[model samples]
Target: MKIRCIAIDDEPWALTLIEKYVKQLPQLELVATFEDAIAGSEFLRKYPVDLLFLDINMPDMNGITLASSLINKPFIVFTTAYKKFAYEGFELEAIDYLLKPFDLDRFQKAVDKVEKAMLAAKLSQKSNDASIFVWSEHQQVKVILSEIMFIESRKDYTCFHLYNKPKLLTLLPLKKTEELLPSQEFVRVHRSYIVPVKEIRKIASRKVVLQSGEELPIGRLYADNVSALVKL
Candidate 1:
């Protein structure tokens, strides 16, 4: 994974060192460097990056203050000569703290932590995408995508049929319900019915036979798409 990063330091030599170190790593993509903290903050507002190499001591603005003001904060790695700011940096949940005049080995260790954190974040997002939350019975309920067998329209409400569980009824129109489901996993076979693609056993005589042995009629408008599943 290419990690887009930027460095902000008032010292030109520090920025040069950061750029040189970033270029040595194949996974690191240094997008931009800033010598002014205020200009760096403005750039961050317009374009969010994955990582930030920030200097704590700047004449214009304090690095910690700028980090706190950001609405979408990136993973921060604070670089400074002073050790007093280490506690404050950790309080902001900085990935790592690098002392100034540090060698390449220390910088590589900080980047390793960032990579692990990014990988964990991606895995968590994938897990969240495999489920959905809906208001049911006056409380939000999590519906696992894999457990869904079919969906049936009931006027202004929709009923979810799941595997080995009681049916769930939610106050949503069929069109709204369809928008929440993944298209590749579920299909609208009729005006009143939506079935999981994997649960479909066969299609015959304009009827879809599910793996559970229940059959649903295919609507005239949706017959072409429903029949196409047989070709798969």
Candidate 2:
């Protein structure tokens, strides 16, 4: 499994050490490193990572405080020189707490725990019923797997096109909504559109024709993602 990660520390040397250790493990992909806790927190807000290696004491905002405030929380491993903060880390449900000057072996153990937790979470999601619920027309509307034809992002909201129902205009981001659907059933062919794999009727050089005769342009960057649509 590929684990995307980021290391945040006030100390330059600490960040370097963790970066080196992360690189030693081929499974870990270091997205970015930060010396400022506030900047690191902002990065997490925009981009989601599988794991985070955080230092406790820092200027502006502390590690524990920053971790708690994150809306999309990643599996965090606290790295700090102070042992007194271990209990606080536990309260935040951190995967592991590593003391300063720890070796690569200790880092490996923490990463191992992250991998196992991620696997278990994936399995749990797969075993559950596959469906997406959205608030539309002032009510929570449950959309089944087969009812959806396609999804379009409209600035601040997402529009769900259905077979026999009116299009659902809900307050949702395309990226977040994509995460809620089964990957095999949905294909995101553009930044603004996600088509149900089964609904695709034909694919051209730059666009796709749906079974309902809807044509959506394929994004330049996301073109490769729609190759599976060709087979179906």
Candidate 3:
């Protein structure tokens, strides 16, 4: 699959160079380019891409601040002239840091890393879409993995909330249910709640909102899990 990408750099030459390098790779698609970080941030809010080529020293808002504020972050490659920002860039889990005057070979290396990461994510998601059997109503029930929205825990039972279907209440505990689901697809946001990562629409103010408009509280202990969700 082609990885959709966008470049944001205050320097026109930097943006042009990134565009040229992106065009050289068949696996990468350049969707847009911006010389203003604010304008690029707006575009990202409306359009989600797989990867980003970002310069760190733009005016008004630098790349580090912009990257940290994104709710849905893309794989980032920080392209800048300054070497001092390398630690900060990697701390944000950037795919690569390309110093100024980088050649096509260096750009290709960063793209290679992005491509590998994307492939791995796709494979993990595929594995999460497999069906599993659950005991409900004294019988074995077949549940489609992809249809699950979230799993809620009751005092002595676990509820499997599916899309457009009745929830299944089993005698199983939430901990046992968590063990059965794929770790990559399901996350425990609270002691009593486990939500599918893909089903999460937004996370704000210690609350996890699902795509269905259902909001669940993010437990104090699980707050870090919610933070990690955005990075995923």
> What TM-score fits each model?
0.59, 0.56, 0.59
Query: What is the per-residue lDDT of model 3 for residues 1-232, given as tens digits with 9 covering 90 to 100?
Result: 7899999999999998988887888988999999999999999999999999999999999999999989999999999999999999999999999999899999999998998988888886876668888899899998788899899998988999999999899988898888988887889999999998988999989898899999999999999888988887
| TM-score, structure 2 vs. true | 0.56
User: How would you encode candidate 1's per-residue C-alpha lDDT over 1-232 as one tens digit per residue?
Assistant: 7999999999999999999999899999999999999999999999999999999989879899989898999999999988999999999999999999878999999999999999988865774469878878999999987788889998878999999999999997888888998786789999999998878998889889899999999999999778677677
Candidate 3 Cα misplacement greater than 4 A, ranges = 134-138, 141-232
Q: Relative to the true structure, how large is the alpha-carbon lDDT of every model?
A: 0.91, 0.90, 0.92
| Model 2 backbone overlap count | 0
List the candidate numbers ranked by TM-score, top first: 3, 1, 2
Model 2 vs truth, CA RMSD: 15.9
The TM-score obtained by model 1 is 0.59
Q: State the weakest 10-residue window (summed lDDT) of model 1.
A: 120-129
Greater-TM-score candidate between 2 and 3: 3
lDDT of 2 at 6: 95
Candidate 2 lDDT, 96-166, residue by residue in tens = 99999899999999999999999988865664446778887789989876778899999989999888988
Worst 10 residues of 2 by lDDT: 123-132
